[model samples]
Target: MSAYKNLVPRFLRYVKVNTRSDEFSDTIPSSPREVAFLKDLAKELTQIGLSEVNYNPENGYVTALLPSNTTAVVPTIGFIAHVDTADFNAEGVNPQIHENYDGTSVIKLDPAGKYVLDPAEFPNLKNYQGHTLITTDGTTLLGADDKAGVAEIITAMEYLINHPDILHGDIKVGFGPDEEIGTGADHFDVQAFNADFAYTVDGGPLGQLEFETFNAAGAHVVIAGKNVHTSAAKGVMINAIQLGIDFQNALPQDQTPETTSGREGFYHLMRFEGTVEQTTLDYIIRDFKRDGLETRKAIMQQVADDLNHQYQNRIQLTLKDQYYNMVDIIKEHMSVVEIAEAAMQALNITPDETPVRGGTDGSKLSFMGLPTPNLFAGGENMHGRYEYVSTDTMEKATDVILKISELNVQQH
Candidate 1:
């Protein structure tokens, strides 16, 4: 029997629900389906015998507590994962389960054989040999970026609840929405959570742990122009679409997501809409260092200013800081990281201390006075159609969570 017998079923059930968040929405959860999923999760937590189960619609966070089974006064630790998937086609997600994957064959994803999970493209698939691999059909994302995390956390908590011999301190579990939209931590109640430290079960690959993340910001640029008949147009009319393309060209072409990796910052143009009268461009700025992030933002403003000067001040720019690197906050609470590292070591899972290329809810929470780090939940190629999760890796992550709880009591 699989050690995590309940983990697979739980993940499959959660991913089937379309919980993709909307970036354009102003509401709390950003989508109605996310609220429904959060409510269902709250009930499930209660059914699993977790105490103090509550879901706040105002912020769309579901929180539950597992009372301490031991008298040791260890720090109250929290486990967190987001309920909503990324901005992808999440409807009709038919999960494909491949048992005892040989790790050498191309896994067909659709009846038409349009999408194949090939090892040649994704070399990481080779690591899951002899393990059960779960993926999605060609039409939609697998939702494994975080649904796997959600299942692993809940299964770990269930394991603790069933095994009375395993002693632990007060444990808290949180499920939130809109993480993919970068607003998951906007209204998080950190003070009420009352945990000295926490971990976001939202990292990729097995044994991956993260304490550093990108200093992130989003920029919106709008260009306005007067339109005239093309036959009579010369200096009398300005083409907004052409001006928008010029603005993009003004930025460093080499400093982009496609050309950068491993602490190298990039300006990613996420969306572009254009017409003869008006054009809008959306971009995200990321860097490991705060100074670098600020410089990048300044460079964008300078480009906008230069364009506006030439175009009679017709360009408008808005840049908003989303989250900062959690390293500065987590460094002060190194024991929180040490506990997770020790837990992984205890289970013989070599910890991979990697810096996150993207931000997590913990990145924002760490700044909110809760020293939270990220732990892997065993998914690969997140946020897309090629997403997959190894059942063995997820089982190890669950063991890490349980072991961390136990280690906290014993070490303290």
Candidate 2:
């Protein structure tokens, strides 16, 4: 594998820019800082000699192309990664690099030594022995969930551009914002990208090649109540907060995110805000099968309806389908999955084919006329302060991208 010396540096530089997205924001990128980063990334793409570099401020998408050097009549491939981080404190992100990890001692993250990344708590750190690891300062997430992927894609493109001897076909590169909030691919122009198939470099750990993702939906429950004086509130005042709790309690206790794993569907109550007069419950529903997701939604509605009937219609429910499992779409284009597996096998990286517990931008892209799959970005403990990524693993991911490109041409 070629040495990708700049991967860690590029990731550190990108994560420090404060690109945390807002889920409630009504903007394309969901955060203003993401636009600034997109501008800088567009310029960086142009500087790195990628052709047709363009940043669409309208949708907060940055795209470019590396035209094929050979006339192989191969399928045009794409590599995509989101630019925005999750809903964590991404401001003032100070990345710490631990070179040649010994894999036994605990890594102190904060200057006060109160926060640490211990191998006992996160056993995955032991896998990075003798590899350089990049982590946050225990105050914010490392943003390696996808930024590592962004840097790896850029590094791979640079490698291909530098080594002209390795012939390949036209490769499309995309960097989008708002993936953490599930709106990253909302405005992606699939026709404009024009790739037959694509891979999202946005999964956790190494060798994670995912084509199936959760069939997802969002549910909002609003409870309205009449507030009266406590002394004179007998039979007149209704506590909305209690009613919200009742609604939540009505759901199956065992079928929740905390209790389920490995293709078991769950109804996760993400946020709850309540007062005496009104209350709001935000829920996320996940299932690998479409019918399972429908069953979950139906049960939620039934619970709400039963409560409303008993309480004279004081509860309202709104369930919106977010994204569907990509397995249905990917099954039609099995070659996309086969190509990625073949590339990983060529590099001797054991392909870990697993279903994503959460939805990805690829889920939406697959439904939008592109057979896109998710590839691992080599990060563990994502969306938190303990997030860390192995530089060696990221270099291998870059090599996988290049190998996929090369193998695609050779097979064609």
Candidate 3:
């Protein structure tokens, strides 16, 4: 907020911690590294003069409170971000800094030029021509997905602690682990993180403000087959792997992650493991509406039903809902969205009210009685090696946090 005074340094420091989460791990934080980093962050919050700073090991969240300086009644707002990176290589993340980018030059991410960040492919690079850009060195991911959010939140809170004259009501800050694997907020203690409403500083690009996210569900399909000797396998054997492929073909091929955009829904085949005796297919279904998600789920069920009738009940399908669109809960509390939009406008930032294609912790938190909207953290091309964040945009994001805190009290 103070013109990148602490934002860039904090971000650079946090991204190097190697807090990548594991989807296969059954632990609460998913990774032991995340637990250690979260404990360190809890200590840092306490050292920064924040009140009630505590790390709950049960939920793996470090929560703190910036107590109000004013006696006037105002709603207690919260800000949340995650500490874990996505399912990518995050070891020894050496960030590259490009100052005053010329807007047209190609960015070689490695000495061998194996990975390059070019304006022709990523035209958003042109938008931050004169701003500082932080990117990965092509050896690993930059972890800016939420580290940028974590840094911005802490910097804005630090600024408020330094300048108490800018009075406001109580502000809550929460940082959690394992968000990348989609289970971080599953055990989140929303009651303990008490706030009237919250905002997730976990969006991409500049001016991104989102309250809508995909209505998500995960499906697991297993097919059983009779394995017979090839010498006598003439009508006695059923190949489960072939049946799995048939099931996949039955789904709409045109509707997929690469082929869809905006509000369009998709059935993503994430993992497929098979053998002649048995095969398993793991899929994630995403849609913006609940009915659309249900329709997709029904399609999977019908595929299983038809296949089971043919194979004598050799197929098993399990479907589970992951999260819902936060807009369904946020629309009733439009003030939360209006305050963020007003804050961005006050800082001369255009409010991009685009819907997120994926889910955030807010997607679950909003349903847990906290209506949260998402604000940008200035990162682009998240979850991969080409990921980058604009320091100028991060400073603006921090300023938006401060402005939102200030305006919440002024308007209330």
Worst 10 residues of 2 by lDDT: 1-10
Worst 10 residues of 1 by lDDT: 1-10
After the best TM-score superposition of candidate 2, give how far the Cα of residue 142 lies from its true spot, in angstroms. 0.7
Question: How many steric overlaps does candidate 3 have?
Answer: 0
Residue 168 of model 1, lDDT score: 95
Candidate 3 residue-wise lDDT, 171-256, digit = tens: 99999998888899999898999999999999998899999999999999999989999899888999999999999999999999
176 Cα displacement, candidate 1 (Å): 0.2
In model 2, the number of clashes is 0
| Segments of candidate 1 deviating more than 4 angstroms | none
Clashes of each: 0, 0, 0
lDDT of 1 at 232: 86
lDDT of 2 by residue, 59-106 (tens): 899999999999879999999999898888898999998989998879
lDDT by residue for model 1 (12-87), tens: 9999999999999999989999999999999999999999999987899999999999977889999999989987
Tell me the TM-score of each prediction against the true structure. 0.99, 0.98, 0.98
As for lDDT, the candidate ahead, 2 or 3, is: 3
Give me candidate 2's TM-score against the actual structure: 0.98
Q: What's the lDDT for all of these models? A: 0.93, 0.92, 0.93
User: What TM-score should be assigned to candidate 1?
Assistant: 0.99
